[model samples]
Target: MMTLEEFKEKNYGKRGNTERDELEAGYENFKIGALIHDTRLEMGMTRHNLQKK
Candidate 1:
């Protein structure tokens, strides 16, 4: 099986390629969103509650 880095390179191009950069940025955003969602859940907060605050 190919390594994760090898898979990424094969699919998204090299680290410096435009598609790879965009993919990296999108992944970062997804991670941040997941963190926020998890933290909110841990604090017993819903999306509606945050919107009103």
Candidate 2:
């Protein structure tokens, strides 16, 4: 099987391409959201609790 980088290159074009850049930005946003979610869970904060703060 191809690596993730190779798969991205084959399906999305090189890093500088507009589609690739947008995909990368989306992935970064997802990563940030995941990190925040995990942190909130670790802190024993539910969504409602977080919203209160």
Candidate 3:
């Protein structure tokens, strides 16, 4: 898990700081969602099953 501070430092660029931060945040969330999806598949669970639980 990356803290916001770490992300900020790693993503800092010459311009578009705000846009880059937002993009990084979105990418991080997407990564987390992908991990969750992969874990469910590994456990032989469908999205429907996860939603019902």
RMSD of each: 0.9, 0.7, 6.0
Please, what are the lDDT tens digits per residue for candidate 2 over residues 11-48? 99999999999999999999999999999999999999
Worst 10 residues of 1 by lDDT: 44-53
Give the local distance difference test score of model 1.
0.94
Summarize candidate 1's per-residue lDDT along 1-53 as a digit string, tens digits. 99988999999999999999999999999999999899989989999986787
- Sorted on lDDT, best first, the list reads 2, 1, 3
Deviating ranges (above 4 Å) for candidate 2? none
lDDT of 3 by residue, 1-53 (tens): 99886766677742368877677789899999999999999999999999999
**lDDT winner between candidates 1 and 3:** 1
For every model shown, the clashing-pair count is: 0, 0, 0
Candidate 2: lDDT of 53?
95
TM-score of 2: 0.94
Clashing pairs in 1: none
Candidate 2 worst ten-residue window by lDDT:
3-12
